[model samples]
Target: MSAWAADRQRSRVRPGDPGWPSDVSWQQLNQQVGGALIKVESPIAACVEAPTSAACAQLFKSLRNPYFIGDDVALTQHLGWVDAWTSKPSAYAVAARNASDVAAAVHFARRNNLRLVVKGGGHSYQGTSNAADSLLVWTRRMNEIRLHDGFVAAGCGGHVAPQRAVSVGAGAVWAQVYDAVTTQRGAYVQGGGCTTVGVAGLVQSGGFGSFSKAFGTAAANLLEAEVVTADGQVRVANACTNPELFWGLKGGGGGSLGVITRLTLRVHELPEKFGAVDMSIKAASPEAFRRLIGLFIDFYGKRLMNPHWGEQVRLQTNNIMRVSMLCQGLDRGAAQHAWQPFLEAVSAAPGDFRFESSPVIVSMTARDYWVPTTLKRALGLVKVDDRPGAPISNMYWPGDQLTVGEFVHGFDSAWLPAALLRDDQREALSDALFASSRQWWISLYFNKGLAGGSAEAIDAAKDTATSPAVLDAFALAIIGAEEQPAYPGIAGHEPDLARGRRAAQGIARAVAELRKVAPNGGAYVAESNYFEPDWQRAYWGTNYPRLQAAKTQFDPEGLFFVHNGVGSEDWSADGFSRKA
Candidate 1:
């Protein structure tokens, strides 16, 4: 056998070998590519009963926490890089400039028995973009955008390029797309509020935005995609070719079946400048808070049937309920006219409250509209190097007006105050939670009473893998502890395992309590609690079987996996490895 092959054989201990890359093994691998193909890893904990080698000890001491992330090559090659919220590190990272590069990376990962992670924008909340002991394929170098007839094709890593029908790269952020399309193409795309969020991840996660009422969801607008499946074959998925894959790609949740390299999205014309009414109401006491919540829910019920309307309601720890709205195709006058009923409801509320109106013609294209409100401000309070992921849950209001009002009052009155921490504990966690308060925020996307048969309407009969609950939903609700980490979904990486367990359990309790009100409703897969009891039922509902079938066909080897993603239940949550 060759010297390198012999070295590799020697390196493989009988389940007791040192986890060290010998000099010979490194030399041989590097020589094949004229240089290092893989860098030395930081000294991770060795498996039990590992063989002790002097060289391994030296390597460990000399190169503590060895990782390629800071190397010059890594800096240039890595596209939009980010680590985990818990600071978990990937074993190695490789950049893909083309489909072939992606295929090569896949092959190398499989051969080396390394977990593979595909990162387009690196904005995954659950930290799926950076997996421990995994090979990360960075797609940032593949940035290229092309416009074609009737459609636009975007490289997965490229900036957003717009046409009459825009094509957005998977890595392209919402702000970039808005800037490219709004002025040049005279169109607006439905996307998340944050500018830095990736189009690919958002769309694949059942995304919605201000214009959702008029334009449907970002997933619903997906026209086609180019993907590299588990077997390392580059494939095209659309209405006609690979239709099943296309359906799965629409909103089966990101990183499930394959690495999406490009996306073709359907863009709509700008109906009118976006207009909204901003109103804030504060209650003098807890009883007033209940009344304010009831009024807000009543307003939501009134406007829920308007396809061109959407509302964001926030219940703050200081007993403040803020309501902001977006009325697509409505001017300032039209919005005022439409909001009269809501205004009346608030005015007639029983409580000591003050309603402050900051009505402005906030153009959607303007910076003010794009700025994230409470969540962003809250994120800024406990500033860290990188923005952490949030723990979130989606609740749909399936009740009538009276039922919704009752549900809202009950949740705000019964659950929120009870779950809040005492003043002493609140002070300790104040940085993590902006106000040391427990808050529940809801953004209701009026999907009902939409102009039926309109191209923009969400069709339940459509084959996309997005949750069936989204089509029949009334609102998206998120409840979180203010004094906790801003990204509510991340239970946190406590050094004490027991402490971590308690923290997670606390979050699970809150989630369970909130779920009680929306028992019959489904959740948006993208912004949901990580510890969802029956995730399949909560996220995909009855559509889980079809999504699973598609996953089996495209990735029978279970190459691509993410937490809470389709077929992810088959794997262990701890390492995403196959279950015994």
Candidate 2:
């Protein structure tokens, strides 16, 4: 027999084996790495004897550790934050300090015939960052940000002149970037609202932000990236070098093509002033709520071409709705004048809809409005807030205006029926279905590139790998909320997996109904369903084939795999080839 075959047979742990790895083997393997290595523990036991034990405390502090194995509670909490359904048990974890470290981890896992998972920020809603019985390379500890004359260096430090860009570490959070630039240079990048979200994960999945109306998505702002391919070679992918890899990295979703180590992104000057407004409306009944939602959708359809206006509307089962907005370069007076028409329409509505400031728009600067939300906690970063609960939602890329009539049909056909289920029925239903019966939200992202005429607008087709559907989108929303039973469910800690599945189905059905209103429209990958029926078409649109080619070129071995990512069709959730 071959030497390798003999070694494999000797190490094999047959099913139901009493002891896997011969006890001492795990410790010996742990000692092989330079960074911290931790043996996974049970959170329940750890919490019971020592509620305030070091292990429990380490869960929050070890977020930036170079390496550590998470206990059951740590793993559960981490998974719970992003996705409850995608949670699974993991026995080992390694925190990589640099590209070489990553290469070693990859080698170790491959030689051991172990599944490997790459994690950044732990914010993958689809739970692609985790797997059962997998070796997880958590990159959160590889955080570094440096600034040079014109350019800023992230984890993999490099200096480039003309200084128009910032190189961000794969593990760096968006809040860090925002605070660094705005505090030092009065600048900012198009990034997510939440500060703790990792820049690499969001950018790779096509990120949008408050400034996207004027600047474009975080992916569009990307100029270059440094990634470690399956062969363990650290390659720099940029517009001029490894351009296809560059294209794929821009919006192909994280942990797919490779482990993104660093990113160089073009930065934009923040407006001298940032302004915002909030408006609230109450509907007496479901019919009124439908009308108000339709009117808001119509407003976005007409105002889609406006580059400086951004609005977010939330709808609830209690016949209540709210609107929040951000306007750049415009003072309070100018912003009010610009939004007068929309304000007038709200007042004319049959529902009790009005601005927070009656008959006028009250705009506040970023300092006055946004900063106070966190009570001067962390500079530049929003206070760490919980993510929306067991959200079963999808993006609605509206191509045209939606009337109150159409809005009524949408709610009646897609939403209201789900919400009408009894509390017991909702509980009995899968988490996916129960969560789908929640609240509805509409987020308006103005695409300047699609708006035409603006020199700043990105050409969705040519600029990056982001879905072109966003280019034509007038009002995009993830409009589902949980009500019958609170999401993450009443259990609080242990999540309902069955409910998660049902919620997935509900989201799919909801998407199908919304698609009828805009058949040609597509969904956003980051805010989309985990099991989207035609995920490739929904996330990448016409860019799928190109992204697929890039995936094959850079990762032919399929080393970096994630569900719903490009070329993911070849692999099942367990890292097994579906073709087999």
Candidate 3:
């Protein structure tokens, strides 16, 4: 069956659910959304049990050139970019080229009291990033990166390439930005893990990277921001300037803070040459298992290790795991030297180990930062782009003591390597590494020495959301299924509850553990799964109260509700009921 038909049968909820009203209340909601923003329209008239003859009008006016409009015309002047993780579409969007445009939209929404969704350069798990029924404002066109007064001032309404970075910035488009800075400009940045995510999500969510252990989280490098408040006024915020907002935005999930228009970031020097490597283990024997886990523990305990060495391991099942090591130094040879210990630890046994390595050239000038995550996040990447399934939820993984064996061991069934693999590319890489293992694959990222290499200093900073555990890294589980579980009533239709629940339970366990390790630990907002609001509060803990206050003070009308954003009511004492 076609993907759309198959999904319709499995969606968690549909438009016509009882909660989706068609009465006067619905009409009133429609009217509010209609005039919420200038040049914006509403789609309430199209719903069944509708009111009058009028439908949400197309956003364009009588001008010969038609640009910007409702969901139908979103493809023209995109106010939002569709997320690649899931097929969930954004209802309406706006490409705000200037801050004034942002002001206009905010003011319009305030006047009409409509719900507004803000679009960054990435995706949300469901319809949070972009949706069909809500108002959207795309901020990709605001791409202008400049170096001014020893600081990098980036535009907000659109994607802004970083002004500078010592390594890389948080909320950066990993691969793309890495390629641009290192490959093109000979500079590099330490961004939030994923290459296709966004800076907005990263910065607000207290971004962490390989260098976080070295230089600290992306938030540590931030200097200031020009944000469009709910009041439709732009303000430059920092420890000195709206310090409270600055503190909240530092790691408090972007949407919750305000519409960030520009980010004044700290930039740094890049490494001369970097090493990227991925290794796999069969671990068919006890010795192999001991070596794998032993090496992991040793590396975690190392003190002489490179300040730039960043390593990660994923043991799928059967004691098999993939280890990725990155070290940034003056030379690739030196990087290799720092990585030698882990390599030796895993390759001690024959037929049980396989590894690959690549050299990453570093930037020497205009150090640090990049954005424009993925093509799907860009207007150009949307049409004919391949945005697959399952929305990515930002989660708080605050601990470092997790084992893949535990997750798969208790499943009461065999685990497939395919399940752990994020996409086809990883599968190919895995095949090239293993001749016998057919059930799993390892994903890899090079550009080691993120910040200072290990997460040791991060623990000291305690700067992340909820004061996350300082030593933990990040993981991105890319899957191709969008529908949640339900009793299968049709072909290819199965409930995602059990599976989703398992994922949630595992994440919940991780969060609980992190709180124990580094209570300040938190994950990027884009990675949130939207399973529990309270857990989310834990992810953005210390800042939730302040964010709510910002909403109450700036947007008392509560007309703005960006997708995946922390809603004002959700933070209120009464809001606790929504989590249930």
Q: Rate the local accuracy (lDDT) of all candidates.
A: 0.53, 0.57, 0.43
- Each prediction's TM-score versus the true structure: 0.69, 0.75, 0.59
Off by over 4 Å in 1: 1-85, 152-164, 348-351, 356-455, 481-510
C-alpha RMSD by candidate, in order: 12.0, 9.9, 13.3
* lDDT-better candidate, 1 vs 3: 1
Instruction: Provide the clashing-pair count of each candidate structure.
Output: 9, 17, 67
lDDT-wise, the better of 2 and 3 is 2
- Summarize candidate 3's per-residue lDDT along 1-580 as a digit string, tens digits: 9965453333322245433324464344335444333333333223222322233111111110111111132322111111212222334344566666666666654443344567665434333444444445666555555444244333332334435543222223334444554445665454654444456656666665655545556666666777888888988776556766776677666565567776655555666544445555566664555455445544543522346655455544355666655545545555566556766665665565544332222322223222323432453311111223412211111111121001111111011222222343333323322321222322222211122244534543454342332233323221111222111222222234455445444434433422342233333354343433444454554555666675666556445554445564432221111222
Q: How close is candidate 3 to the true structure, as a TM-score?
A: 0.59
Could you tell me how far off, in angstroms, the CA of residue 540 lies in candidate 3 after the best superposition? Answer: 2.9
Scored against the true structure, residue 435 in model 3 reaches a CA lDDT of 22
What TM-score does structure 2 among the candidates reach? 0.75
For 403-489, candidate 1 gives per-residue lDDT tens digits of: 110101111111111111233432322222222124333333333212222444667224567766555455555542211111112
Task: Report how far residue 423 has shifted in candidate 1, in Å.
Answer: 39
- Number of the top-ranking candidate, with TM-score as the measure: 2
